[model samples]
Target: MLTNRQLQILQVIVDDFVTSAQPVGSRQISKKDWITFSPATIRNEMADLEELGFLEKTHTSSGRVPSEKGYRFYVDHLLQPQIIQADEANQIQSVFKQQMIEMEQLIRESANILSELTTYTTILLGPDVQQHKVKKFQIVPLTEQSAVAIIVTDNGHVENRLLTLPNGFSPSDIEKMVNILNDRLTGVPLQELHLKLEVEALEILKQHVKTADTVIQSLLNVSTGQKEGKIYYGGKTNMLNQPEFHDLNKIRMLMDLMDKESQLQSLFKPKDKGIQIRIGSENNHMAMENCSVITAPFSVGEEQYGAIAIIGPTRMDYKRVVTLLDMMRNGLSRALTKP
Candidate 1:
């Protein structure tokens, strides 16, 4: 619904604000070499854009800043696909070059690199472990009172938990409990392991093991822990450097949100398989009203696995972040799915 000239002016305002964190005046837009309009004509366009809700005039300055709607429109309509520079592409490639690296290490390294490149907070949600079925279960006794409960998933990820053996719980009871877990839980997805254990395995354990309740509780703790993808963070404190985050109250809310797993999980949940951008209030959380989040889902082959997200002020460098995220998403998918 916008004229070409109006769109051109809006893009300029967004680009300038993103770089300088200041309201952009018509004089500034007119100074661009590509802009053919005079300052008066550009100011008319700016006024029109503001009336259309794409720009907001600040109380302290005559210059204009892009509203949240402006940023959305710019990203959806005016943003151009940016080609990753060779050196930056090489930097991303370096994350995958190591041989025999653990999955956690790869994801952790990717998060760090993305944060370093963007200079923003980066979050990587690891592959969903619930989709992986149980591959093996073992309980190794450490002493008469304690043992290590190990759960190995089909993806080769291992989880270990220390369980305190119940008083008078015998070696025979331990052996029986391990047998029941392997029999009823092998090949079961981690998400369903807890319910399956309670419904089908608990009765079997009770018939054979004297301390079935205690044993089931310990196993449930381990299975429940693996129900969600692990979260990895890089540059968690980078947001403190952004000018918008200088407010103490805002910083406190954001920091609290980061420490909470459920909140962080919700932030990364993807609406679709492609890149998703939530600017300001679109996030529906007050703590994020001044922030923008960009998410890119990564997959292994055709199965969507997990996602990566970057959080920054609403004046984010959308073109650069989007391009880098897509490149990294493709690279992560290839690295994960490679045979």
Candidate 2:
């Protein structure tokens, strides 16, 4: 538990360091308009804060820098809601107001806008199509041995897979399979379609189709193998401008991590329904130890569709970024789900 004075001093130190990227000295803190403490008294509190591991005294200077512990505490306790400027609020509103048709384009543009607004790297994960229910299913025949199976989701996304027909498969087999799938699987979420088929649709298909085994196997593959959400990035190179990334080895590692889709996906933990902040070391990646990640999940209707993440130095402007994400997520959800 920190005294009121300690909390006040900590907030000022964090705010100042975030702006200037410099270690803060007691004398520098005493000069703030709101601080009434003399330099000596403030320095005593600084030393105590350092002893408590909330602050670190750099070897090169007597001034103090907030430790990861300090940052975590500050974020959890001291942050107040920051109102964005009217022009900036208008800019965000304009994104949703645009007559955009495709959700992907809207998400991509949002990523760019956020990165520009925060001057940090932005990552937007597109809606997970697996959560979408089946609106329709279509089978189009091509050659005697091959055909295409199309799955249309309730949200109007279409996924097509080419399948090799089993020997002796006939048009009646195709028609029966399509009818059985449409009858049984319509309105089933894609992620649940596989289990629903194995448990429910298989028995129905067996009763109707001659080549039930092969046909059911192909459908199973389709449900289980659909791609996960696509990732969109904005200001991929923006981290290069942060002073902490000047180390060549750090920059190389960070750039490499960004190139990997699998690793990048790991940054957004599951069930992150609200704004979550992970500071340095909490991020659990070597490349991100000097970084901070702020994530907010966006949704389509009631289901969690995807997430947005902003990556910046640990000395991030938390108040501003959090405000932007809070507004942006609501706007995105509304636009995507609007009738």
Model number with the top TM-score: 1
What pairs collide in candidate 1? none
Candidate 1 lDDT over 110-172, as tens digits, reads 999999999999999887777767878999988988899988876556778888898888888
For model 2, where is the 10-residue window of minimal lDDT? 263-272
lDDT of 2 by residue, 22-133 (tens): 9999989999999998999999999999999899998988899999999999999999878999999988888888773456678888999999999999998777778888
Total clashing pairs for each candidate: 0, 0
Number of clashes found in candidate 1: 0
Worst 10-residue lDDT window for candidate 1 reads 219-228
RMSD of each: 4.1, 4.9
Candidate 1 residue runs with Cα over 4 Å from true position: 135-152, 161-186, 191-221, 300-304
Candidate 1 CA-lDDT value: 0.88
Best by lDDT: 1
